[model samples]
Target: MSKVWMRTRGWVRRARPLVSLALVLAVLAACAPGPGSERADIKIGVQGPITGQWALEGLGFRNAVALLADEVNAQGGPLGDGRSIVLVEGDDRGDADEARRVAERLIAEGVIAVVGAYNSDATAASAPLYDEAGIIQITPSSTATDLTQHGYSRFFRVCYLDDRQGLFVASLMATELHVKRAALVHDGSLYARGLADWTQRYLQEQGIEVVYFGAVTPGQRDFTPVIQALDESGAEAVYFTAYWREAGLLVRQMREMGVDDVRFLAGDAVNNPEFAQIAGAEAAAGSLISTFPLPRDLQSPEAVAFSSAYEARYGEAPQSIYTLMAADGFRLLVDAMKETGSVDPADLAAHLHAIQDYPGISGPIEGYDEKGDRIGAGHVVYVVTEEGDFELFKP
Candidate 1:
């Protein structure tokens, strides 16, 4: 009996290695990427100037994307497969070189889609990189028309084009403001130059003569020479296709220089609350800006809810309209992903192009045309109030 027991113990010890090998193989098969394997996290990238002059705009976009991602995750995430959305942020500092580098880094990080780089120049410079990678890039605020004209199917924007915005302002100046002549100034940047040219052209087409068309260095504070030119031109309206900083300086100087009789018009760049703060309430009052409608004025439940939620979360009302666009752009991407049941950027782009009249917080995203420009999307007319807030322009 003792001999039999020793033999049995040896047999069991010899079989232990074979049993352990079978268990290891089973575990390996389960862990490998194949049928019934767990899905990895889906990554979405948001790139912007988180530390530069335009950091507010970039941060606003990043915040909106975060909000959307959180909501999606809270709702059990995408595809109902336990797969979650992970947000990866890249700070481009609003520089072209940095933007390209950031774009490449995000691509390497395995982001399927990206939303960001607020400025037109940054977006224009970095778009080719994304196009080469075939990733979807939906800009929340880059409005330069040439961005779409490049035929990069991967690029799309929720904002209106620079030319369309300029034309909208020109139509208002001619039909509503009833101006016979207007003065125009550009910041010499691609966006401002293109906007100024288009607005000038539209004014000319409407028989409203452009009395003075000139350029100015963006960061320059002294606008006395430009104000003098406008004053000498006998223009009934003054349109400056520049940003908030220069717009504020120009408006303040014009007021001080006794050019208050003429209507001061500005572009979407001055649509922020900072514009009013910089220009002063009294000076900013009655100033008209071609912009997108504020969330409060949008009247959609989604818009209203978004405004309230954002204010609650951030402890302040959204100062820039780009936040709304960013949220909408993110929703479009996620909605596409959900609908197609795929995380592929190409799938998202196809669904985005096919999307028609997507009810958005900003407005109805009427889908993208062949040029990737928003179809049937236009700018809103806003006037500064005494409280230094945007009010829907009745006229």
Candidate 2:
């Protein structure tokens, strides 16, 4: 062997044990959880209807949060110091009392933040609890007009407000659908009343005749009475401002009562697969809905990637807009946490208010206004196809 070869061999022999020791130590480090790992796992409460009619939306939010937790933690989570997310599930069952209970429980659990209450009525019911506790509560859905009106600094929502949705629907009715005479029906709930009232005002302002205005006791089995009123009033269209469960029943009842020629329009709450499930694909066809941005309308690369990842992880496509908004809500919280380097709701609230043009999978949030309403948030128009899926309305 040459002199150079002999020297190289000696160096390799001397370094071998040290290199082996380093490899063993690295493996041990990888196997053992780090010292700060336990402290770093931040607990966030996720509240929604896990067992009621709106359970699908709640479950979707849970799945989206789980997916995001996994993804964020893989990159070292919000703090980027080996921190991770730990979600505490709160099932509100879509009831006001249950929602209040859930909110109180989450606050008692010492969670840093909360995401929940898919329906606006439930959200409004629970908002006081979170606000009193000073816990940052970001809802993935819930679009009642007055959600942000109470001036709760910790309360925020990713979806557009009911006023925007109602306005858009009224415009669609006047200019596109050319609705002249209509009937308005709403469940006697805060959400339904606010949305329906706004739409009714806008419709009348546009010179559309509101032939019948009525309210229904939600969870009632029969909507035939309301359908008969619409028929008698000779309404060219019927607008229902409520959740899918009631909307589905009302639509089906209207069809059953031979109110076929009158077009049906609804709000964001009906933008779910359960709507079709309850109304039947045949019954749901040709209904127009006002809602947040649909997955098909998302053109951002982040949105496209998120949709693909969500499908791959869940083994199915997302059926509700809440899933995307839930993910965005979580992202917004985490981003605030990172920016402020604190889990304090007050700090999160400040950061949230300051965020501008946050690129989210749902859509870019232009930040919160003085009342905490998301600036630049708007609604889209969709029509249910024969197959009972929402597609962008051409008209």
Q: Against the hidden reference, what TM-scores do the models get? A: 0.89, 0.87
lDDT of each: 0.82, 0.82
Steric collisions counted per model: 0, 0
Give a tens-digit lDDT track for model 2, residues 1-395.
11111110111223456568788667655545332234545778889988877788998888888888777778887888776677878899889988988888777666778888788878999998888888888998888888888879888888888887777878888998898998888998888999999999889988998999998887887988888888999999988888888888888888888789999988888777678778988999999888886776797987888888889988886767788899899999998988888877798899998899899888888888866778875688788999988788887
Query: Which pairs of residues clash in candidate 1, taking residues 3 or more apart in a chain or in different chains?
Result: none
